[model samples]
Target: MSNVTLHISKNFKELLQFLKSISFSRAIRVGIAVTLPVLMGIQLGYFEIGLALSFGAFWSSPSDVSGSFRHKIKGILISATLVMIVSFIKGYLHFQLWLLLPVLGLLTFTIAYISIYGFRASLISFSGLMALVLSFANESEELEIYQYAVLIGVGGLWYLLLSKAWHRINPKAETEEFLSETFLLTSELIETRGKLVNPHEDHEKLQSKLLKLQSDLTTNHETLREILILSRRTSGWSNYQNKRLLIFVQLIEMLETAISNPVNYHRMDVLFNDHPQYIKRFQDLIFEMSYQLRMISEAGNDHRKLPKNDFMRQCFENVRRDVALLRETKYYEEYLMLQNLLEYQEKQFEKLKSIKRLLGDPNSTEINVIDRKKAKRFIAPQDYDPKLLLRNFSFRSTIFRHSVRLAVTVMIGYALGSIFAFQNPYSILLIVIVIMRPSYGLTRSRAKDRMIGTLIGGAIAFGVVFMIQDPYVYGIMGVISLVIALSLVQKNYKASATFITLSVVFIYAILSPDVLSLIKFRILDTLVGAGLSYAAMLWLWPAWEFVEMKESIEKSVKANKDFLHKIIEYYLLKGHIPTSYNIARKQAFLETSNLSSAFQRMTQEPKSKQREMNKVYELVVLNHNFLASLASLSTYIQHYDTTEASERFKTATEKIAFNLERVVQCLKDKTCNGAGASSEDTTLFDDQLPVFNYLEINTLKSNDTETLRELQEAHLVWEQLEWLFSISGRMLKLSASVKLD
Candidate 1:
């Protein structure tokens, strides 16, 4: 019994430590975020009004937690200010009700297109429209608009303060958490790269990892930017240092790409092997670069100018010189590829330098956008179509399903409001609208979490209202509501909802002066709202199609083919060609996300669709794995430097070229059949296939050992290519079996 007690105690301590590491402050901020909207509703003396505000607050919470205090505050101010301005125009200028929708839509499009305002623009447009519609219905003009501005300002201000306080306690701990994860991923890629054998597999895996790293980098970029803005306002270094930390991230990405691509590896390996002194110098340069970044991050914390250390300057010069040498010699054959990569890195360093400059000039007021354009454009072809709006309106599309769900929500809200004789039916509509965010396969899970949170919040509010019975409790409860509202500022939706419910109960209990009756009505109204939202979502579409997943798989396959084609063309052209490995990496990452989302969606669907989707998903996974293998092969080929070509090597190259052409033809025709070559046509050179026969090997001097070594390496690469084609062909065949079904 004593031993058991000790074990339990140890387990409990471990659990506590884990929880502490996860940033409780961020969670509390989320809770506060939820409470703010509720407070706004209370100030309006309408639960429905509060519910509407709370919806926007919930959606914005996730971004706030990861973003800068300035960004969050700016978003809130913009949204609230827009709402106020729109409300005023409707109330005072008496804008025509019919014109409001188009005006709001245009404003939303402009804001979304022009600025880095994020989701706040959408919130503003929706809220502004809501305000305009309400103004038209009530005809209560300027006074109502003023009241809204005051309430929204109060709520937003409360959130800002609360979020700031939370961050002060934690000190950019959340940002660190994200960065730490990114570093771990980088480390994993490095470890994998070190152990890579098959160039094809290595390439595919490296590209996959690189894509994931890029995504993580993009996410961190936004987070760090937010932190930087917050730090600027609060006289803090946490956010600034975090933004500077992105330099290391960019370096890691560069190194990972170089390590993954065979052509780059060969160039580096040859340079290092031929010039041992240069290799040591290169190592020293990298060390100095890393150290300089670390020093910059530390200096930024103290609000000091970043050091213009000699080591860093020398390291930069060395990198530039090496890149210049590669370009001038055209040594790698793909020197242009190397040049492009160097240019990208140079831009990244420049951005870092700019950030450092900004940190140095304390009085500089301009908010400069970081000139890092590393984010991959994965815009689907369908997204660019002018007919997208019409397609979205079609019954087959999810948007139409969402509209039906909205209609059901409105009907349910009206029915429940009439049945209970509630003063406002719009409150129910707002709740339903807010909760019914379009989700993929995890709709049930999300709904369950929301329901649980609502119940918990409702219970807490009931207890709080019951305890505080004085008339002055209304004002006191308002202050309590503020605290609760602030706590939800940077938390998840469920936790935020809990605080929102708690805030609403206190507001209603104090204002109505009837605790028990108000509590009963509040609970009923919330249940009705939540239930309606869930039912509408589940029954309307019933099945959410896994289109994103399908698109992802198709994109990945296309990218893989492109990468293969580039590598083959590079070798065949003989005069150094660039590989589209970077493009492939970006596509692979997208495919992973799409596949994951598809799997999740499949799980939610009926067994028949789920089975079919799962089969398709399996094919995607196989293709991803095959591409990774091909990447590894490419790396090996590039690394091998041989000057002479053997007859066997020439034969292997011919076979690979033939297979590739056939594969391309099949893809062009959208066919599942293997290439039309007969088994008897297994000759090294087919006279009828003029394209394959015309391919000639570049001749080198007999004494040019380096050229001979490259030729030998090219032969090995040819053999590996044949193997990859065989494996990939089989996988593609398997995938076709499922896709065709």
Candidate 2:
């Protein structure tokens, strides 16, 4: 009997603990959600009145997960100040409603553009919306506007504090999560490369994956870079792990390039075959390097000592051989091209060593340059060229799409406001204008989320009003607001939605002194606003066709051709290619990004464009894969250890280069003429004596077995290159046919 009683008691205790845990989490989320809305209501009371105005402002400025706190805060502050000034001017000048309309329109457009470009455009947009709302609210009491600003400021401050606190607790976790995603993507690329049956087809897929990985890796690297800068501001926080993270990122990039162009690996094997130990050692070293990086990331600051076992020694030896082979092959050209990256890693590693040395000494006096200037210098903005931007915009029509969406949004907002005759009809217009947004693709998803969130929020608000009264309600609302603010930190949309829901409820129920009977009116108003916004989105110049997909695929093809031309030119120059190579790389990345954006947009459009968009998306994918293969081939060709090979390698390289030029010319002619051309006319892959003659002439005069073997491997690679180029030309022709049709 005693045992049974004890068991029951234990179970009850466990259940209580679980409920408490859940409640705590709920409180946090609720606190974050209600923080801003409640403050807005408290400062500017009137139940439905202030709540409606605050909702419009908040809706306009949805927080962006990608943006930094500083950027978001700066944008928000700028927007708030502008709104405040506008409000002040309205009171001072007593501007007429007719004159205010045009000014408000201009302000809206400027805010829209800034929001689009700025990290947290949503916030800026909201600020501008608030300003406009205040200008038009001639019926409302003047003091109400100032109260609204004070509340919003309070909410903003509360959210800012919560976000900062959360980040401090888990500064690197988000970065690590992003890195893990990249590593998984890298693994996928390797797996895909191993399964290639048709080199061309597989190569295309590889290129697509490589391009995607490169973009993702670059973005992730930026995040880590930011984190490292932030770490410097906090005493005892180290960026040593981040430096190692950057190294692995570079290594992964090289590996992807290597896999895409098997010829490079073949060349490496050829040059160091006699000393098989070198190749083995190099492989081991790469493995060790990857392992060490993972370890440092996992262990954080507690991690000490590199893996100095026998396995590490073997790997180091391999690294030495790989370096030697790279040097011997006069691959110095390739190394030089990638030299900046190498230097960056070396410097980062040196910094880590310095940090470690400092950590070792309790009284170390080394000055850690953790200032903004140093951070800015370290995290240089990727050089931007206007020409490239123009090229991308011209090819993909991204600007046109955005412009169309914006115009439609305003038109819908005006129509709804004029048509609807609710007590606060402008609220419906505000919702339409603010929610419809700059892109049709994202509008529906966000709108649906907003609807669901608002409904849930209304219910929560009703419950809070019924259960709590006065000061306790205010305290509970504050806690709920904190939770919503924290949800902004997560990547998931659902998290954001939940927080938004919680926020709306608290603002309506607790902050606003609207009577219990008026709760139903508030709910109805929210639904009406959501419904009108949704209707406007569906009917207003609805984008049924995805034109961007076709444009992106077409642009990618052009970018690929340009990249190939650059590679050919670089090889022809023999040593250290011009800066144009980097331009080509950047162009490729931009095209890929455009393709992704296009695809995302297409998914939101009507089903009519689905088939055409899918076909074009496939082509875009193929083009990316091909580009990756080409990049790999370039890396291999540039790094081939020519010292041990016969002169035949050089002669063959020149012949290959010449053939590539011919191919480019033929493609240009075909593109310009728009005429049908036969495969025979293109000399598609016929390995006649000229190709071999070039190879034979370039063979090195060496008697050593290893040297002879290296020469033989070079000849094999040359033959493979010839075959690959032929395949590529045919694929290009096929791609052109699809595009023309």
The numbered model that scores best in lDDT is 1
Q: How would you encode candidate 2's per-residue C-alpha lDDT over 288-399 as one tens digit per residue?
A: 4445444433333353543234664564444544554544565542322222222222333343344334333434344443344534443445333545434534313443
Q: Model 2 lDDT vs. the true structure?
A: 0.48
Give the per-residue lDDT digits (tens) of candidate 1, residues 380-472.
221334454555555565544554555555555655675677855556655654566455344454455556766887787667666667656
The number of the candidate with the highest TM-score is 2
Error of 2 at 181 (Å): 6.6
- Model 1 accuracy (lDDT, Cα): 0.49
Poorest lDDT segment (10 consecutive residues) of candidate 1 = 688-697
